[model samples]
Target: MALIITDECINCDVCEPECPNEAISQGEEIYIINPALCTECVGHYDVPQCVEVCPVDCISSDPNMVESKEQLQEKYHALMGKQ
Candidate 1:
């Protein structure tokens, strides 16, 4: 599943660079994750780097874009160039 930044984000810009997929971005007053590009670090890393580095620990699973492991891997493959 993709991760999301909650309103608790402190706008510290800590989690943006930690994302392997470049999915994190600055919003009006906080950070937002692009669900289409977020694979929860499936192909690039073992865990969600954004969540690992988030200062406020505001990054959490996005319920709106729930996906299984296979589905997430498929999405990663499509984005990273594979069958």
Candidate 2:
């Protein structure tokens, strides 16, 4: 997944359904992204929808789960139809 929920998340459910790939889910105290299902909205929207809707600004790229643009694009297309 390109983004992750920080500890700052107030357990708010604002960022869940906003995900285009259905990647976000509720965790212990906050939401978590399913990396395998997360395409970072690459082939769906122009920007990361989760990052835009997060009230606490708790979403950030996963440093340990790095991916290249091409890889992201492939994932996006795999999950969504290409234009």
- The pairs that clash in candidate 2 are none
Each prediction's TM-score versus the true structure:
0.94, 0.88
lDDT of each: 0.88, 0.84
Stretches off by above 4 angstroms in model 1 are none
21-82: candidate 2 lDDT, tens digit per residue: 89999987778998887878887788898889888898999998898778888888877766
**Clash pairs, model 1 backbone:** none
- Candidate 1 deviates by what RMSD? 0.9
Candidate 2 C-alpha error for residue 64, in Å:
0.6
Off by over 4 Å in 2: 81-83
Q: Write the per-residue lDDT of candidate 1 for residues 1-83, one digit (tens) a residue.
A: 88899999998878888887788899988889999999999988888888888767888998889899888899899988899
Worst 10 residues of 2 by lDDT: 74-83
Candidate closest to the true structure, highest TM-score = 1
